[model samples]
Target: MRKEKVHINIVVIGHVDSGKSTTTGHLIYKLGGIDKRVIERFEKEAAEMNKRSFKYAWVLDKLKAERERGITIDIALWKFETTKYYCTVIDAPGHRDFIKNMITGTSQADCAVLIIDSTTGGFEAGISKDGQTREHALLAFTLGVKQMICCCNKRVIERFEKEAAEMNKRSFKYAWVLDKLKAERERGITIDIALWKFETTKYYCTVIDAPGHRDFIKNMITGTSQADCAVLIIDSTTGGFEAGISKDGQTREHALLAFTLGVKQMICCCNKMDATTPKYSKARYDEIVKEVSSYLKKVGYNPDKIPFVPISGFEGDNMIERSTNLDWYKGPTLLEALDLIQEPKRPTDKPLRLPLQDVYKIGGIGTVPVGRVETGVLKPGMVVTFGPTGLTTEVKSVEMHHEALQEALPGDNVGFNVKNVAVKDLKRGFVASNSKEDPAKEAASFTSQVIIMNHPGQIGNGYAPVLDCHTSHIAVKFAEILTKIDRRSGKELEKEPKFLKNGDAGFVKMIPTKPMVVETFSEYPPLGRFAVRDMRQTVAVGVIKSVEKKDPTGAKVTKAAAKKK
Candidate 1:
């Protein structure tokens, strides 16, 4: 008896110069050998196309059959059958322009094949120079396969392991951190956020390990925005320390971001202490602390108050226990420094401000708006007002993962069904707040303190760029350049500067291109701090100092909300 063939979907992805198309075509061409005559026909077809006898043109011969020459933007699908399974392959384009197609292909793929040129300069042509191998990262994040989340290196522990196993020597030191998500550790890089909550000596701690991957900078913003304290990890080895703290390093960038995003408290861990030339050298540790402290001061942090803890993450020295290797150091261990952090007051007592992440209409549920509560509490009986249009509705039910809750607090992502609210009436950017208490409205214009971190060109009045605040992404115009200010002191530096260049801090008045809900940093923090996104990168970051709100006009109120009022 013959058995039925199972179906499989494979996606081919890589950098533009990485021969994705060539690899895909070769696979199909070789599979053509399954039918011996088909291979001969392909050779005949190839010979006819390359009658010019150009060996260099032979590279284009196979693609010519597919009718695509230079850089195929669209995904090409092909089919072939094996003895046990039927396979469908998608030739997903590798260029950034075709990211949507790549995302589409990646999501549908049962397996993804990343093609590499492997040749000298061909490998250097794209992608890899930056820390991320974006192809594998896209696949890992999209599929959420392999949990790649055991902090992706437990960064190698859910329970911190004591020094054990002689095999866990030299490079094996980090084996424990990567052991949890062993597969990704083979890549030897953690390209994404590693969020793990564990109790320290004094407080329950959440470590949002924001690795310095340029592609995931937005993740850094999101992680630091919620953090009460930032754990700054640094390389203490000879060249490693210099490379990490240099102008091009991401450590300085992250520190600046953390300070800008309101992570007032921080613990600077001088990591890889064991790897120092003389082994846990106090001289090396002091040198790093001196340089980092000066850099932190420029970023607006009071370096004197920030604790510098020396530790080796790989060797597990001074992370939880004091390192005898460095008896010269008297400071508390990593865990002890964490215990010193003073908890910031929770915003639950403030007026409710929940930025909608998504809106959905279910079979039985009317309209559900899902978001994390940035402040205050959300309950079933409350009258909710959505900003921009001031659409009002009464919350019929509040649920987290299909289970009803009495109230949802800050940081709780919940989907609440609203009475008389249609799906069209809500969207991701809209702010949901208590109807009768400090309700959110659209902003006409706002004043903000913006620091240009990375911009290809100068930013001046009338330069409109997309601003990412909370769940909203809107183009906001720089209405006026008020004054350039000293980053550390916030003192006026220049009056109405012609333009703000990279690393310049200035007060600017902004006008949104569309309806956007924003509040002063003092009032609603999550909605106040925004990333100035331009050219597909976070060119600048700003904190809303003040807002001029537009009064609501002809706003819609649900029947349920009206009756309650």
Candidate 2:
């Protein structure tokens, strides 16, 4: 009998040059995951380019422009297996320009692995004031990565250490360090998520490596929102953990945001312990635990339940195997911790509601709509209704993952052909459901509870912002501010507040400028939650409380005139 495999999605995240790609590539290679021939080809190419040090990174940086530029410009996918699990690795770009790609990659992850550089100044630079490291971490936490693994890239640390030693022999200055780091910083970025799989001894894991630059925070939010857990990596060297958790750093922000987003579990990894002296490593470990635990407590996390492990990605210590260097530390290996993470319960028993992602017209398939089933079931031959267009069509066929199926359930990403629906009649962001049972309708106006995330100035009635709900993006106006409420307590504070500023929560009436399909949050959450964007950034997030249909307006006939006629 074939063994059943459990699946988990994981995303890799960190600042650029923190060895996110290298660590991921090396981990997969160390597991005997990469094909020998592919590695040989990459090695040969690196040798010919006189950049042989990039051979490992070449595994995921498959694009010619990326290899030439020595950076990951898009999401690269690869799959492998462990003794008991299958895994998918999503290698996302780390450059600031490709943050959109990172967001796309992170959005589908169930867990996250944050890679940190363990070099003397590397960690400091990454988590420094206004560094991408903190932003990426916070983004992962806010997006819902509850369980996390922090992997400090010791290989890069060793390389940097050697370079620094050589520079010191030549009486190097800070400018020299900047020059060296600058050379590694010039590379292109990407904006798409790649999908791949691997397996461990106990479960299947899908990993996404998201971008870490500040410009990509939007994408990062989108990516992390789908995760359930996260792993935080810290360098096991002097000043490593301190700098990361400092006020200007993102460690605290990431943890706090993750908690706010409902991620309840986290794994803190102290990486590069192998590179430090036993005494120093132990001391650093103790210091980090104390500092991080204190901060996590302030952020409302149960610090005692968070597992802290010491590992070296380069040396393969305490990752797939237990490390002997840290005799004092006793905890599960990185892989083991991943296997122990509990899968979140999926809501599949609700009514059928599939948010249309795209509409395509295949040569033979006619008109087909594609999307993930957010709730309930979809089957061929069912008469489905799509709203706000109110177009009714029959499902001619269903296809998922390139295979035909009689029916599709929640969480399944499927594309199905529809009968009597023209390509022009359909658009993205429409909801498809059973025509005879609770047919979808166009929402005329809705009341919502909103939390303002960002805004340049105060917002009053008639303030228009783009509402992003499911796959639908439409402009909506604040018809009225019914009440202002406390963000934490949800207590009513004021009625009809003149204006709302950043960080404020309120109950407001909203009217979409165009037709939209929305449901009350209490009834269908998948379609009820929305993001409000203005001036190109998300200003608020809201949930629909109730909707008022648009009643037709017409001229009334007078009773006296009717009698005379």
Q: Per-candidate TM vs. native?
A: 0.59, 0.70
CA shift of 261, model 2, Å: 6.1
lDDT per residue for candidate 2 within 1-565, as digits (tens), equals 0137544555555444444555555556666666767656555555454444455555555445555544444444444455555554544444444444444344334455555544444455445433334434544444344555555444323244544532211111100111112122123222222334456775555444433333443333333333344455554444554354444343433343333333344555555554444332666556555655555554445556666666665456677777676566677777776676666444567777887645889997799897556667899877777777666667878985356978775534568998756788788668888766776778889999988755779999999986756556679999999999998899999999999998899999999999888888677755666666566344566768998754223322223223323
Best by TM-score: 2
Error of 1 at 358 (Å): 7.6
CA shift at 75, candidate 2, in angstroms? 5.5
Give per-residue CA lDDT, model 1, range 419-533, as digits (tens): 9877998986798999889999999999999888768789988999877566566799999999999976999999999999988999999999999898998888767776665
Question: Worst lDDT window (10 residues) for model 2?
Answer: 170-179
lDDT of model 2 at residue 346?
A: 45
**Model 1: lDDT of residue 244:** 36
Predicted model with the maximum lDDT: 2
How many clashes does each candidate structure show, in the order listed? 4, 54
lDDT of each: 0.49, 0.54
